[model samples]
Target: MVSTVFYVFIFLLALLSYIFIKRNNREPHKRLKLPPGSMGWPYIGETLKLYSQDPNSFFAAKQKRYGEIFKTHILGCKCIMLASPEAAKFVLVTQAHLFKPTYPKSKERLIGPSALFFHQGDYHIRLRKLVQGSLSLVAIRNLVSDIQAIAVSASDSWVSGQIISTFHEMKRYSFEVGILAIFGHLEERYREELKKNYSIVDRGYNSFPTNIPGTPYKKALLARKRLSKILSEIISERKEKRLLEKDLLGCLLNSKDEKGQVLTDEQLADNIIGVLFAAQDTTASVMTWIVKYLHDHPKLLEAVKAEQKEIGKFNDLNNLPLSWTQTRKMPVSYKVVLESLRMASIISFTFREAVDDVEYKGYLIPKGWKVMPLFRNIHHNPEFFTDPQKFDPSRFEVPPKPNTFMPFGSGVHACPGNELAKLEILTMVHHLVTKFRWEVVGSESGIQYGPFPVPQEGLPARFWRESSS
Candidate 1:
C-alpha cells in the first residue's frame, strides 16, 4: 500500500509539471499577434512588475521602452494596455460593445450578480437608460436647490481659523447631495450607515476573495449585506407609498420596457446602490482634489471667487431667476473646474474585456483579454497638451484633439452624471471661495493616489474669512 501511494504522488507531480510547461510554450494564436511586452515566466507573468510600488510610473517606463501597445498579465488574466489616442478611441468608441467592464468576480463578491456594473449587453443598456433621465439637464436644474442647500449646510458647520479636513467635509456634502437627489430625503442615519458600508467595499477592491475571519473580503461581504438590506427597505417604503415624486428612485420605479415590463425588485435595488456608489465615492475624491488645488494655488482661488461673485450670492445659486444665458458667462469658474479634472483625474484607468479577436496597428488582440486605456496617459500626453503637468485652465479654453481629455470617459457608458457632478463641484467651490479663505498646510506631494488619487491624509487646511466682504 505504501509503495502504491508513493507511485501515485510521483505521477501527479509529473503531470502538473507537464501542464505548466505546455501552458508556457503555447503558441500565440495565428490571428492574434499581441503587442510587444516582456511576459516573464509562467503563472506569475509580469504581474508583480505591473503591480509594483508605483504602477503609473512603471507603465510610463514601459511605454517609453515599448511604444503605445503592450501586453501584460494582471489578476491571472492576459491584458493589453493601450496608450495612443487612436487605440483609446478604438477601444472606447468603435469597439465598446466588444469590451465590457472587466471586473466580474470583484463585482460579484462586493455587490452580487444583480449590480448594474456586472450586467452587460441588453441588460446594462436597459438599466443605463432607466437612470439616465434622472441625470438629464432638466432633472439637474430641478435638483439645484437641494444641492445648494446641502453645500450651505456643510459650509455653515465650518469654523473660521480652525484646521479642518476638507476631504471628510466634501464626502459628507456629496453623500448628502446624492441622497437628496436620488431619494429626495436627507436621512442622516442611513447616510452614515451607507458610508461605512462603502468604505468596506472600497477596501475590498484589490483583496483576495477569501471570506475568512479577518479578511477584507469578509468585511466587504458583511458590508454588502447591510447595504442591500438598507436599499431593500428604501425600495419597499417607496413601493408602499407609491408616491410619484420626480427623484431618481421615482424615475427608476416608473420606467418600463417596450413590452411594459418593469425591473425586478432585486434589479431595482442593485441599480440604486450602483448609482449611489458611483455618485458619492468619485465625487468626494474629485471635490477633495479641487479644494486642494485651490488651496495650493491662491491665484486660481481668486479667479474662481471672482467668477462666483459675478454669478451672485448663495441665495441666487439655485434661483432659476438666474438665466442660462447668465450661467454661460462664468467662463473662469468653468475653466477652473475643467483644469482641476484634467490635473487630478478621478478615475485613473477604465477597464474593458474584449469579446472577440480584433486587429489594431499590426497587433492582434485576442478575445477574453482585458484592455485598459490609461486616462492619465492621455490627460498628460505632451503631444496633446504642452507642459501637461502644469495646471493651466487655458488648455481647455480651446479644446484639444477628440480623445485628448476624457475625465468623464467617452461613448455610451460615459458618466451620465457628468453635468450634475460638474455643477455640484462648481457650486461647492464657489461657496468655499466666497465663505472662507483657505491655505494648504503641507507639501503638495503629501496628497496620495488610491484607486482614485485623493489626499492620503485628509486635506488639512487653515481657513479665514475672505476680507473682500
Candidate 2:
C-alpha cells in the first residue's frame, strides 16, 4: 500500500514537470509578423516626418514604395497605414468588431478625455444614437434660417473693395453659427470671447503635445479651463431657470442614455465644446476650400450658380429660408462639397486599434496596434477616382465605390455629425453663391494639412453682393 501511494505521487510530479517545461519552451507570441516597414528611431519614430511641412508628399512617396498596408511607428504607437478601399472596409466595416476607435494622446487631451469623440464600443453607439436623436431632421430644418442669417451677416461684413481672408471669414461665420445654435444669442463681446477661447483650443490640436509654459498645448488647457467655467455658469443658469429650449445645449441637457441616465454636467460640457470645435473648424475649412476651388474652376462655379438659381426659384432667395428637401436636392452643390472634401481631405487619417492579433490580407496586425485609415491617400488613388488630384466636381456626379469616398469615414465609427456638417456646408454655399459674386485676389497657397486642411494665406479674396456691386 505504501508503494502504491509513492507511485501515484511520482506520476503527479512528472505531469507538473512536463507542463512547466512546455510553457518555457513555447515561442514568444509568434513574433507579430508585422507588415514590412521601418520603425525609425526608438521614440518619436517618423512622427515629425509624417507631420512635416509637406506631409502629403511624404505619405505619397512612402505609399509608392511600400504597397498599401505597411508597418511603422508613429505618434508613440506602432501603426499600419491602410490606404486602399479594401483595407478601409476591412478595418472599418467587414471586421469592424475586431477594431476600436482610437486617437493620439494629443487629440484626446485637447478634445477632452470624456468627450463623445473618444467613446468606443456599446457606449459609443449609445452616445451616437442619443445625439442623433437630438440632431433630428426637424431640428436641423429649424436651424437653416438661423444658419443662413449668420452666413449672410458675415458675408455682408466683407466690404466690396476690402481684401479679406476667406478662411478667417468662414471661421468666424461657422463659429458664430455653432455658438448661436449651442449657446443661444449673446452680446458681441461674449461671442468674440468664446471664439477666442475656442480658437486657442483648435490651434492646440495642431500644435505639439507639450504642456510647458507658453506652449500652445498649455495655453489651450488654460483656455479650456476658462471655457469650462463659462459653460458651467451657463448650465447653472439654465438649470435654475428650468427653461426648455430647442438649441443644442438644451437638447443635451435633456439627453438620456439607453439606460435612461442623463449626461453628467461635465460630460455635457465636454461634448458641447467638442461639437462646436468640430462644427466650426471642419465646416469652415471645407467651405473655405470650396471657395478657392470654385474660383479656380469657373465652369463648375457657373454650374453651381445655376443649381442655386433653380433652388431659389421655388422661394424668394432673399427672404425665405431653404427647406431641408431643397438642400438635399441640390446635386451640383452636393458634388461640389464632395469634391472639396475629397481634395482638401480635412480629416487626413483616423485611428483604430486591433482588438486582437488580427490577420488581414495575409498580414498580421498585432493586438493593441493602431490601424490608421489613410483617407487622403484613398481619396487620391487613381484606381478609385480617376485623375484623383484634379478638382473635378463632376467625378462625384456618379458616386464612387463603397469605401472609395470616405471624407466622413465609414462603418459604425463614422462621424456622427457628418450629416449636420453637410447641412452646414450646403447652407454656406447656397447663401454665398446666391448673395455674392467673389473672385480670388491671390493664388491659393497650397493647403497646409498637419491637423486639418487650411490654405497657407487663408485664401484672401474680394467679394461683393450682386445688388451692392
Q: Cα RMSD (Å) per model?
A: 8.3, 4.0
Instruction: Assess every candidate by TM-score.
Output: 0.87, 0.88
Stretches of model 1 off by over 4 angstroms after superposition: 1-32, 160-162, 186-189, 203-208, 313-328
As a TM-score, model 1 comes out at 0.87
Candidate 1: clashing residue pairs, number: 0
Candidate 2 lDDT over 1-469, as tens digits, reads 9999999999999999998777666634454477888788899898888776588787788788888989888778999888899999998898988988787777776667777768777767766675665566766777777777887788877866989988889888888877876767755766677778888888877787787989998999888887887777778888898978877788888777668988787787788887887777778889999988888888988899889977776677456678787887998889899999999998888888998878877778888999988999999999998998799888977878888889887887677677778888899898888778888876666776635778877888898776622
lDDT of 1 at 411: 77
Instruction: Give the TM-score (vs. native) of candidate 2.
Output: 0.88
- Model 2 stretches astray by more than 4 angstroms: 1-32, 184-190, 258-260, 317-319, 467-469
Q: Candidate 2: worst 10 consecutive residues by lDDT?
A: 23-32
